[model samples]
Target: MELMILLSLIGAVCSADITAFGQFMISRPIFCGPLFGYILGDIYTGLWLGLIVEMMWINAIPMGVSVPVDLTMMTILSVVWSCTAFQGCQEAAIFALALAIPFAYLYSEVDLGGRLFNTKIMHWIEKGIEQGKEYRITQGIFIGLFLFILRAGIAYFVFFIVGGIIFKQVYSFLPYEVVYGLKKAWYYLPVFGFGAVMYNFRNIKIPFLRK
Candidate 1:
């Protein structure tokens, strides 16, 4: 359990680095999921979950103004939690995936905060230019990265530690009936998510079979 906790904490920091310091693209589940999975020793499940999310949200890009969802943090946290707690259990996978949505929303808030922080940096940049300060742009980038990484790392650390304890205690009392409901819901959520994606694709360029 100690190793499990340590691994999760480390993964969270690394995941933060994806968008916070490194290229934003690597934050995608394609990269981060396998990372959490590898740490938890359940690479297969992590990879599959990442793949599913990647395809389902292929169009959910962060355009100039559009925020979309923070799928990378979602993948990282979900994979870390699921891999640590559930291991290779399908039921746990479903639960983690469901839980990830709320965390994704939380991450969105964090990202928004980062953007707001950038506004302050922007003002500083303006001031720097007026005063003939060199390399304000680089300083701004570093500050942006720092704010993003700090928030993500701290948020993840708290959620996993505090949330993990509660999750274990609560799940211990989960009745079979409730578990069944979760299973049913789990089986269907992906269908809806994937269906929406497929619908979008078919609308843009109808996919078909030539029989």
Candidate 2:
């Protein structure tokens, strides 16, 4: 449990880095999933989860002021729940992904609010500039970044606990038919994910198909 908590916090920081500081691709599930998995001592599970999420959300890009749902948080929460709560159950992993989507949307709202608050910080820096205090620029950046990490960390920590409990309980009550379906989806969903990825990258058209 402690290890899972730590991994969730780390996941929050790395995910935040994508937009907050680094803007590196590390926020993508391809990187984020395996990271939490590795930290939790289950790299393959993480790899599968990451691949599924990356493909499923291949088109989730932030354009203009529109914030997409937080895929990174989804990946982290799903992976953590699967690894810790279910521990290598493919059906549980799929269920975990299903469970994480709503939470991801919640985080998206949080992210939007955070950005709005950062704009206020930007105003403070602008005012400081007029007063010849150049240090406010650095101060604002540091403060914004700290808040970003804190917000993400806290969200992950809370969700990891609550989500894990819910995941275990909900999964335990699932009927055998539902569990069987989830198991099948565990393999079949990836094919759909890959197809979605390929379609996004290069829409392959059949020769006989009418455009």
Candidate 3:
């Protein structure tokens, strides 16, 4: 429970960084994954998995009205599940990544809904200002941020606990060959991710890759 709470807090921070306060890119999987891994005493697992996810979704950038999958959530939840349920198991990391993808998509909807709801809050603040309560604007910002954090924290907590259990149960029953394949995937996935990243930059003159 304590670890879950800590991870939940981290999740909120990462989610907020992606959309709320500092768009410092710390919310990126390359950073967030290792943070979770460090917290769970499995930094290498976290670092490697984070790199893979980061590469795999290298192009999931959000533009104008388009909300891509919440890759931050994917990184956080993947680390939480992989570390807690099956530390040092690449197969588990792969499984966690698979599970994390759909959850990432689900959270994208939640993220969009939250942004929509913020519009209502904006209207409320406007009404308050009409009544001479200009302070409500500041209050509204705080409230919006709090809600963002609350939503992310709760979602991660539930997914960490429930999803972690499901992963553990399912992993325990997998056949050896399948497990070996996943383990192999653990190493190769990053290579694939690197390929994806390179593919994204294929048109650019990346000095080394240019030749």
Q: Number of clashes in every candidate structure?
A: 0, 0, 0
- lDDT over C-alpha atoms for residue 70 of model 1: 75
Each prediction's RMSD to truth: 4.0, 3.5, 2.8
Best by TM-score: 3
Write the residue-wise lDDT of candidate 2 on 38-149 in tens digits: 8877888888989999998899877777788888999989999999877878899889999999998998888889999999999999999999999999999999999998
lDDT at residue 201 of model 3 (Cα atoms): 68
The clash number for model 3 is 0
Cα lDDT tens digits for candidate 3, 1-211: 9878987988888889876887999889999999889988899888988899889888876678777778899988888898887888778888888888888888788888999999999999999999999999899999999999999898888888888888888889989998899889988998898888889767666588765
| Candidate 1 per-residue lDDT over residues 116-210, each given as its tens digit | 77899999998998999869978887777666666766777777766666665666687888778766764566676687667775746335743
Better of 1 and 3 by TM-score: 3
Please give the range of 10 consecutive residues that has the lowest summed lDDT in model 2.
1-10
Q: Estimated TM-score per prediction? A: 0.80, 0.91, 0.93
- Could you tell me which 10 consecutive residues in candidate 3 have the lowest summed lDDT? 202-211
Instruction: Indicate the TM-score of model 2.
Output: 0.91
- C-alpha lDDT values of all predictions: 0.71, 0.88, 0.87
Question: What stretches of model 1 exceed 4 Å from their correct place?
Answer: 1-24, 181-190, 204-211
| Cα-lDDT of candidate 2 | 0.88
